[model samples]
Target chain A: MTAPAPPSVAGARSLVEPVLRDAVARLDPLTARVAGYHLGWSDPYGRPATPGGKALRPALAILSARAAGADVGSCLPAAAAVELVHAFSLLHDDIMDGDRVRRHRPSAWTVFGRSAAMLAGDALLVLAGELLLEQGTRGGVWAARGLAAATQRLIAGQASDLEFEGRPEVSLEECRRMSADKTGSLLACSCSIGAMVAEGPAHLVAALAAFGAQAGLAFQLADDLLGIWGAPEVTGKPVLADLRARKKSLPVVAAITSGTTAGERLAKLLAQPDPLSEPELAEAARLVEEAGGRAWAEAEAEHRLDAAERQLAALDLPRGVREEFGEIIRFIASRDH
Target chain B: MTAPAPPSVAGARSLVEPVLRDAVARLDPLTARVAGYHLGWSDPYGRPATPGGKALRPALAILSARAAGADVGSCLPAAAAVELVHAFSLLHDDIMDGDRVRRHRPSAWTVFGRSAAMLAGDALLVLAGELLLEQGTRGGVWAARGLAAATQRLIAGQASDLEFEGRPEVSLEECRRMSADKTGSLLACSCSIGAMVAEGPAHLVAALAAFGAQAGLAFQLADDLLGIWGAPEVTGKPVLADLRARKKSLPVVAAITSGTTAGERLAKLLAQPDPLSEPELAEAARLVEEAGGRAWAEAEAEHRLDAAERQLAALDLPRGVREEFGEIIRFIASRDH
Candidate 1:
């Protein structure tokens, strides 16, 4: 029997090869190579690798369609488009964040250097539109518009994140706004594009969007938790990793606004030296937990997850469709890393 | 006294407003605002500015259309798209180049910051697709495919530019290829898009593309000259600024390949401590010119400009259109900045 399956990021790795096989079939050799390289489909020496990524978002797009009684065939363009945007953001974001590793390998920028990585990202973004247009979908206009708007929201969310780095007094409302714009928009875009292909009912589209947005907020909250209290073995970094970086994450913002002793201690710890000693970082994490920041965030994630599930339940889908939607919702909210 | 003549950039600037005003009326307000900001129609602070930019490329597109007997009416959408792509490239290029000013004001990133500037650029790029798709002259598939291909070529050109920046040795052939992909592709697209609208003769369309390409190559070479030797008071940078940046301009590349003593001196000068004393910098420029680098570039520019004119002259057109095209040709080749 298979060992209790690892996280879907592991299980989903197997599916990437099939997805890429389909994608590369459409591109010329050069573009396929470039696209493959950009997606971490190649090894450190740039040889083709076990094709990478969880295919998590693309799976959402396809699953949402099937769950909504729509043919997944029509949603393929949207899936590819969303995945391309995701890869574009990841490449550029690594540069901005100075992230050194991705998929247990050197980041694109680290491998090829910064500018090529940026260009590869640019190429991926441009290729998404090319893919959509090539499909000659009747809904091509809406697809382009949908993807463009989602991309803009992605930038807006990223801008807020960068901007918040310097602001010690950011509000809880501001953190929520940032998370919603950054994560929620893309998730909502996935569902909307899925429903769009189905020509699903307008109310159904609205419900899916709401459900996706809620799921996304839960995902982000969970990520913030992992960034703070997560174990090094699990997270690939020391505990209180966000604290070491002085990241103005959801928990940090919650602490600051709650006016608790832990808030004061956390802020003091953040004010200290380079990569704060692990002990110092742990002190800050303890403060965050004692001040109820963890509980607050956990409750919020639960509320949103439940809200998302409720919206999913409202849809009159067949049992098979409903079960798939339920699994995607659970995966989105609970997945680690 | 005779009226003062309009500036070339100003002459190009004048045609942009009416055309943009018409094109954006169909889009949502937020998108239109973003487009306006990118065109420098809005201030760096994001207020509306006068229709800015030398409408050089779009005017060329319209003139080419008329010469090819396409309705000027039909050319407007394509012109807007071509101009938007041009503006998008300039926005991002300024950030990557660390350029702080544009059109006598702060660059977009200087005012909007990098991510916003980047998003603003991305928005314009995407808006261009939306514009072309809506052009409806050709279907969405054709327009999107053409624009996406052009964008990839443009990004590749940019990548080559960035790649060359730190290289100690770069061939002149490499420089020309970069300039062609970077600058020539857009101009070719402008002419090709006009052809699409004009239903221009296939031979004429092909000729227009060749004319635009040669003209674009010449334009970049001339611009490179201006970057090095033109009066900063006129061009908005210090004289020999490209020399100051140690850029791999055509002249410098030619000099390096020539293997002359002065070329060696120029190369050593580029390797000199930055913040090089002004006199030493001036002496370095003299060495480059004395080595025949500047002259080599000027001759190359002349060759391409001549080829561009011959292409246009061969295009069968009404006498009035031919005369206008000639005036535009002279204007493009002779501009100082």
Candidate 2:
């Protein structure tokens, strides 16, 4: 790939802020406060912070469009729309999975309670639809359709995620299937939709979609790796948190299939009711590696990354623009945390 | 006073079924099946049922439009929309309220599990939004606004409802406020949106909204009456289900306020731990009557109907149309079960 364009990180931040700002202003104080808390605009005590999350999904939509030859101004609505969907899912997922901490603070549900959390999530989701309907793009129809489809996939993926509880029979393929639906589907929505809004050539847009899809899979694989092996400081949670929760992440699924002693031990250890001690977490992580799960997951992540690279290479994006998104995809896959 | 027109129950039934049928068909087979079950489309085993919910909401919507002098043909989208919202609320309510039966069968969550139930509800709500968005009427925006507002109220009302458990001091006024948000708001949506789709004059539409709002309050009062004393053969649930559940419905609230012997007994029974037997249920019902709770509730229902009737009388609706809806409101208010 040609030398990377200057990162759209700053451009996207500038572009997306006001859309959200206007949205916040339009809300009544209570819902606005609830929503503000969700955007990490406030602490559990309702105090403001430095703001939060990388705004990755929205950035991807905006960056990909410029990379694919569209103006950033026109893609703002799609960017905001994707961010709302992402936030909505995060809120509900936190509630259902009983995840108490988010961004090193109490999760929205844990603070506001499940009922309010669920309603807040609904409000965000509906806001996405409203954003799409209010879009300036000629493809507002398609934008609405894409956002809705992504929503369905997100829920379906979450359904599978919940189904994976305590069920050791999860196949790697199944994890991949769930990941694609949950993560990759929305990422694909961003890329495909970004290009569509840019009026990027159809074939190029398809390639961008493929790139986003693979990149999303790679991103998730990397996240699973972090969950299992990355340092607690880097990952913002305990090591082997997925194993403790009995989440059927890629590493865990791969380990089960290997049937090594550590793998067998992991399956048995997870069934116990005692809370996972530090040793248990370390032991689980070691078992996954000894069973070749870590290597396998790494290889899978790389393979997806390679596919994303190939799609990018196929696309005739401007050198600077292409390099910017390429760096983003690589960062998503290769970040230590 | 002008004579009320008799509702063509059969005609309304025929008009709404096909609309619901086609709209629900909007989902994929898997999700649609879940939705169909939620709508009383199938047995738990996925087998089809002969028919479904009374389509009462949709019928009211279409009839309200006709009563307001709009072509019924044009209101189909909003009609399907409000019904879907109703169905969405029901699906979620069953899960939250722990109700196991719907329309004489196992609730969708009991049959399909909570996640599927949630998906089904979400699908219906999303489809409702899509239908409203694509409807292309001058009233389309109004329908969307009313629906979004009503749904928010409905959800808030449910939140208030679940909050009432173990709170011994819930007064009659609070119960009325909660029921208005829960039921009255939606009924107002049905008729208001119907008139909106027909582009009826604002004053007349407001009048119809007033009528529907009152009707819904009266309807829910009748429901509270049936909840305690109505027979299972007619009411479709075991008698006194609400009493056993310790539901703080209107009569209980009224009794507490009336401060009679029966009211005192009700207060004591409500504070107890054990299940109320049939005799106990009868005693509680008797106490509510003795304390004038029943009469008060009945009078309240009549007062609402009178308000509804006054609103209808002010509307220059075709005499036949106005009378038909008036009969519906009366039937709703005074139903035996």
Candidate 3:
């Protein structure tokens, strides 16, 4: 049976953004400015910023709290804390990945200078803990602990990702573990923190985290698809941007290990120090598909999405809350950009 | 009055290093390896590391807790947390400053690669919070909050320092403010967290933080002195390394704005885009001293130390605690490295 239309993402974000903005505001003036600009609360010139970013992590956090039977009001801090952490990672990830653009604008490091952006990211991470400290309930300590653990794993994942980038010997297994740590850990935190804030039963909390982990894997696979095939206008990044950097994205790694002629060609092209030309980059993308990387990623995404769906039955969520979460999972799995 | 031959710093460090090591061990294996190397807990080849840093921050934390009448054993986590934050900053600061050497060894970023070092720093910052969360008392939450606040200020301080580095117009006031935030805030946190963990009275805690702030300023001023005048063998850095970078340290900034002929000469020497030659760098250092920068820094340091001393009467510390702490303060003010 078809599920009813899910709750509005915009609605969920609007509910969570104020709290998130308030937390960001608590930074020292200089950091607040950098974080504000990064969060799209202001432009580089200090004028009010136009709305930007999907507010997806906070939406998940709020939805997770609802699924665990909490009202929006009580769960706001958990949602905001997770969003702050998401922004923190984004700031550092841009620096670590050396990407110059994000969300159709110059990335924070490119505009504010790398050191300032890094410091801003550092401030946001601490701010997340500070905001969580104010929660003052028993769950506050547990929630903060969970966030800390997730952040550590996220850092570990990114470290592994960087380590793999310089090595051609990375296996598919290693790549998947990196993806799970880098992406899944924080998403799981978003869920786990929500449940902790709601005082959800331990089993329910574990189930929600499991759902988030699988959903995150699906999200990364979808992201891998977009990195290759999506339009720049939609993705807000140049087409083949990841390939231009010779990033060992999942599909690319899959193709490299496929033991086929096209795979060998892709591997050789990636080893050069010079920037890949447009035609060469395009051909590289095609070779990945032909090497069965695209098909493998698609199947994996579906498999993860299905696995995520099964975890929902383990939660005693209300009907509407369950439907809304299902819609988000579907969105993550199938989004084009 | 002469501070009665301050307690041995090595003695203090020996008390705190094990706790710090235990916390460092909590990181995931890969990050632990990177952090271990940075901390001198392990070699690059994963062999046992030689004795590393001086454990200064943790010593201060533990001493502050003692100054608040808490036993060293009970305050270990708070001390460890401060040390973690200190290491976190060092890791990121190395990246931001682009320095290749730290503690007389290749910096983590240079040896492990920048992204890995950055991720390791991120992991350390989160680990600081996690260790504090395990404090498990009411003071645990407040102590974590204190650490978070200090961390945010430190980031702001670093951000401003980065901004000042690229501009020629930094005022002594701005430089001093940056020093307070970057250095003083964390020192203050060491004291404040110690007191909070002991559940010290609010006024006493504030007084300790105030003392730490003044002492921190003195510490930075002493550091500035060493940056220019300390022997390479003692400081573990090349002679005139700060001058080579044309850093806007208090002395350097004071020299530039001193309105003397020497100050003008130093400014012109600094304005060149190319690196200064050995003769030019030495001349610049002499010019700074000639412009009265050294004297000003020395006097400022004494003034700050005196101010820090006055805050101690407010503490009502145990009999030996105040004397031991006074010795530590003296040590911070006068140490060559």
Candidate 3 residue runs with Cα over 4 Å from true position = A1-7, A256-280, B1-8, B256-277
lDDT score for residue B307 of model 1: 90
Best by lDDT: 3
Question: What order do candidates take by DockQ, descending?
Answer: 3, 1, 2
Candidate maximizing DockQ: 3
At residue B252, give the lDDT of candidate 2.
Answer: 75
Runs in model 1 deviating more than 4 A are: A1-38, A49-52, A64-77, A103-106, A194-207, A258-280, A316-319, B1-52, B61-78, B100-113, B134-141, B166-168, B194-207, B258-291, B314-325
Tell me how far the alpha carbon of residue B217 in candidate 2 is from the true structure, in angstroms, after superposition: 2.0
Compose the digit string of candidate 3's lDDT tens values, residues B1-337. Answer: 1223245456657777787778778776778888889988777877997776776667677777777788778878888888889999999999999989898888888988878788889988998888778978887787898888888888888888887878978889999999999899999888667878888788878888998999999999988888888788767789998898788899989988999999888888998999899999899999999999999999999999889888886657777767766777777778654
* Interface CA root-mean-square deviation for model 2: 3.4
Each model's DockQ?
0.34, 0.22, 0.73
TM-score of each: 0.83, 0.80, 0.93
User: lDDT, candidate 3, residue A115?
Assistant: 84
At residue B212, candidate 2 shows an lDDT of: 86
- Candidate 1 residue A153 C-alpha distance from true site, Å: 1.1
lDDT for B142 (candidate 3): 78
Q: What tens-digit string does per-residue lDDT give for candidate 1 at A114-228?
A: 6566666677788777766665655555566667777767766777787787766788998898889788888887766666656667787678778888988998898899888
TM-score of chain B of 2: 0.93
